[model samples]
Target: MAAPSRNTCGTRERSILDRVPPLLTDLYQFTMAYAYWRAGRHQDSAVFELFFRENPFCGSFSLFAGLNDCLTFLRSFHFTDEDVVFLRSVLPPATDPAFFQFLRGLDCSGVTLHSVPEGTVVFAREPLMEVAGPLAVVQLLETSLLCLVNYASLVCSNAARFRLACGPRRKLLEMGLRRAQGPDGGLTASRYSYIGGFDLTSNVQAGLLFGVPVAGTMAHSYVTSFTSLEEVWPRTLVTVNQDHDPVDLISLTKGWLGRVCELLGAEPGKIHEGELAAFLSYAIAYPQNFLPVIDSYSVTCSGLLNFCAVALALCELGYRPMGVRLDSGDLCKQSVDVRGVLRLCSEHFSISAFDSLIIVGTNNISEQTMVELNTKENEIDVFGVGTHLVTCTKQPSLGCVYKLVEARGRPRMKISEDPEKSTVPGRKAVYRLVDADGHPFLDLLCLALESPPEAGRPLSCHPLGGGSTSLSVTPAQVICLRQEMFTKGQVTQPLSSAAETKAQVQDSLQSLHPRHKRLQEPDSYTVALSETLHTLVTDLRRASTNKSNVVLAN
Candidate 1:
């Protein structure tokens, strides 16, 4: 079969879509595209905005993501000849031939778009992106945008949960690749995980793709490959002593660690006199046991006790093996008991063993369970968040929907019995209110050309009123919310790096009022309609309902 010809997005400079996301959307988008053409709505100008009604993972806040993916989707969007031919083969026998003729001329030429800055903090109900163009073009974007946002947001929310639980020591790693849906699923999950606060990932391709730090340790397979667990050390030591070994390795390893003391200009004898001395010596001799596997099968207290003996021996020999790996049972209890054992042994030997014993947990670390374990004093360090983190088990989808907000100098709204589902009517913009401190407090939605009062002034605009301030903003300063992201089809802003995005999420969360951060029954952020929008919605409602009433009265 011949490859389909690509659709050209009407722009002078190429977009990221020129490389990826071209094939990401489902087949139905094309079928819908054909229908729009047949109905003569293909070139009829329209607009749609993307936003979600709630945050995921039951968290107090959410991180904004997937704008890059959205832009890439838009830029790469095109009807390939193969795509067209497939549509031709699938069209019903009775379908109009003229519709297919129109499909042949399809291109994203008449579309105009707008969006929020990617790293900005957002809330429920507000539009993140506005797509205005032909109806067909707007319809085509729905599936792809939601696909990107849903997954990205899920991982971001998950990462935030971990960040909150981890406290000051935020050493997190993404160990979810193998269980992720596909290769890219793992890759993107790691990307957003870092944006949500993880330190690194174990997926090598993901690390290279998004510049995330990749981390891994020897699997049990390495140990099983050797004759015995004892021989595992000598072989590992040989590799550690290879020609490419770092000088730091010499100081940190057993054979040459005495040299580490000398290089640091300290007496080797004195350095070995402390509790950590024995562990350091063993590390130099047998670095393979760094974070040695303990509960490979059963995670019972007896299992931990057996490993505790080996850990004590390594500590006595001056090598603090990395940490104890827990693979099975009652982690909260076992970790506490293991720490107590190490402490007793260190005291008996008159050595510092507390720092030498690190408890690492793998297998079952989802957001909910991690929070539960984090609350305990016996909780383990270094969680391997695999299936749950990668799969986004709690809220697997973002539910990001795009709808038209305005066109040709007129406001519009989507009406629904559910007020929360009701679209904020008009050509509108979102404003974030900040206080005297450079922290965000509330988000205010208003007409694109409207401005609210200054800080300390009465915030008198009803979020849903027309030309009247029904509910004044309760005593907070107003920070202008909207930012210029694109002009015409050209990008006006630079993309935020993963590091910057994570920092933004952290800072934004700190700035939020305590109520917004509550995991349970989080106080909803104040979202009010600008008076104009409220009035417009009210009028539309009255007109539609009144028309029905008139018919009934007749």
Candidate 2:
């Protein structure tokens, strides 16, 4: 790939950003910007922090994602001529054209962004991203930034849970293309799911766009297409010997059917005709990658037996049968039973290929289902997870909020009646503290100017509540979590590929304590404030309270 232009305002970036209108923001953001402009506070320096208050799906951590997309939006943040015209039409009849001119000239050239890297495991209340610039310009970014990060992080976290359930060895495939929220949502899910440790996706468009590996098998409709064995039997069969005549196809088919009937204790003519035809046709079409959906009619009684017959025939003709898919019934028990049948067929036919056939389970599997299947003895080699992974039905949103934290060098915060809704004030820096065993014990948030915690030093940290917790650090390391993403509207870091980001997630998860990664009732990872930041927050709250009291007394 070519390096980005030094000018930072590339035609490619502008073209990509052109697709996103300036009016994509909420109407309230425009109103606020107008108010600031009227008061001559539009150009005043300000800071905003984007963070979530709680983990989605009741999990302990969230996978930070969509930083690349957010940077793209920032780089391409200009209002088009059409946008200004539309704004004029929407404004009141007596509105000034100077406001439209302001909109026309608006861009993000003065903004600086700092963010945790994509694929980082972040906790609630920690800043995922921070924007520092003019108050009006920064305010305009709130809606778009939240829209990009919220869904991406939610889907990525959900995929991480699924990855945990599948373990390290089992293959996990994203089969959610048909069930995703929309076309763009499907592509986004595939891209982030790869970063969250999925092996492949079934969406080919995503594969083309994001370089994610694409995979899929024939649907059940392919089976129903061949209504009878007569449509596929003799025509699709191939002779084992190259010198043998094509006329021997019928005899070969009959010989395989006889063996299958004898092993299954069924009459040759009474076998499942349509399923057998489909398997034969599909095998003939894709002999090297034949994985027939076996539960179209019956798994054990008919589908399994018919597949074994077709597979044995293919083996005799020098082709390796790939696998079988069980898409219905109790997948755990059905997989065990199907494996037994394959083993029995291998012994009966004296063929070793039957014993090694892959079994895939794909019937609406969820994270809990994967956990349950992991506990039981089963023969499934891969999981084709779909709706549950893409839709994130358990928790569809990751409540990420972008709030103003500082303005004109003064720390600011939003006080709320609910304590959880209260904002963390200031230009903050986040550091991950690793203990002697190399596990991250806690995350420390401090004023950006305050000195970072040093190694081999005992530090006192305070949680959101009033209590202070002390950690004795004899062999620990403190590492900064946030990096400079954008400076003066230019991206500072090269975008990471999906494979690289996936590896980062895997490595980060390895260093995280297992207690914090549990699916249910996970232990909360400590996110604390440094002494200076804690003191500043307390002082601000006290001052705000006194001012409110004075107003009421007056």
Candidate 3:
């Protein structure tokens, strides 16, 4: 294989892929390659398919992702002199030096990849990607490709599920950096989360590197940093106009503070001056976007009061504060209470914009919590989700496997005692059948040489494989799902940007039947085989079972 061709992307994003050096794969991959070399089978042509057996998070579907990273990794794969030296010291002394020389010249030039488009909704048992190349190189690609696709696809699917749990209208923010595995894990989560329908992220590096929208607010420390208005000195604030003279904003804030205390029936002396000063400082810094965490001291007792006073003051100065965030307590109850306060202020002051101010729920929110929030009434406009969003706590890992399905132009199968573990042999074509309503009805697997089903034509297919039941229907639409993406050391397809892929996710979801995409008890999406494929696999399995003297049920 030739080093992945660098002609597909710009230098910046290309650098992300370049970091995936050839040594990134698992140790067993190289060991297998070495064994193949000793048998003079290293250069034999082979085909490997990457697919999962079930959906992650107990959901009915997954979104294809990390195609960009996979391409990048393949494009830049090469054993450097240093990598060879490391391998020499690690391998047994009986290892031939010529093997190291063979590795030095390995690259992805001969490899070709065909994959489902990134962000497209995919189901279990179907190939998300296919890689074909010389036996040794393609075998070595197994672990690394799975490593990139498994978690990338899992986190992306998890984020999408969170979006579904919250509905389409609510904003979803990814704040998983602190809870992510590491810097790269955070970066991966941030990038894929955006593509999975998140509106923004708190990771500045992700914003810089992947173009994810970045947003955040002052923390509890920012509020606790001040104790008196004196520390918030020169409390003058200027309008957006650079030439406008600074106004005595601190005085205005105090006046509003008194008004808020009276309107909310609170003691004027009860409001903490230090918290007020902190709010004042933050408001001055980001008047147009002064969202503050309100649960530090007291959401109702002091924090909310301080926020309202400073917010009203900023509004008086021709700037509207964005909103507030709740990080603790009964989130739904607090959200309701906070909304009541903001709505009362909006009506009292005739500040109609305040009626729509964002209320962010920053609890340790998960998909389950979001669902729970819907049953109880609340006014949370956004959810800044952490931990579970990136880590996929409900399901830690997606089980995607890469298997050699063909070698030297011959189809192969891994016959297993457990039928679930058996491999579907050979290169095949996949077609998605759409109903008259534009919803996908079934996915058909056919031998690569078979003619595809055309619209309005009746088709017969086995249910999965070797099943008695067969599907009988005429498809309104027939779409080829997998196509060549990378080949001849260059990307054959024009890769979409993350934003574009995100749009595709929404569109893909819309194309599925509602029942198939529901959160719980989702109707399983149908995947079946064409007559030719069904017969081929059934006979192959039967012959293998007979050879082992095992009687199989019909």
lDDT string for model 3 (62-155, tens) is 8889898888788778888999999998888888899999999999999999988888899988888989999999998888888889988999
Residue 396 of candidate 3: its Cα lDDT? 86
Q: Write the per-residue lDDT of candidate 1 for residues 57-86, one digit (tens) a residue.
A: 675567777776666555446667676676
Return the TM-score for candidate 1, rounded to 2 decimals: 0.78
Each prediction's whole-model lDDT (CA): 0.63, 0.84, 0.86
Once fitted onto the true fold, the runs of candidate 1 whose alpha carbons sit more than 4 angstroms away are 1-23, 26-28, 93-110, 220-289, 297-321, 340-357, 407-409, 436-439, 463-469, 474-476, 550-554
**Best of the two (1, 3) by lDDT:** 3
> What local lDDT score does residue 331 receive in model 2, on the 0 to 100 scale?
90
Give candidate 2's whole-model lDDT.
0.84
Clashes of 2: 0
Query: TM-score for every candidate vs. truth?
Result: 0.78, 0.93, 0.95
> What's model 2's lDDT at 136?
94
Model 2: pairs clashing at backbone N, Cα or C within 3 Å: none
What local lDDT score does residue 493 receive in model 3, on the 0 to 100 scale?
78
Model 1: per-residue Cα lDDT at residue 449: 74
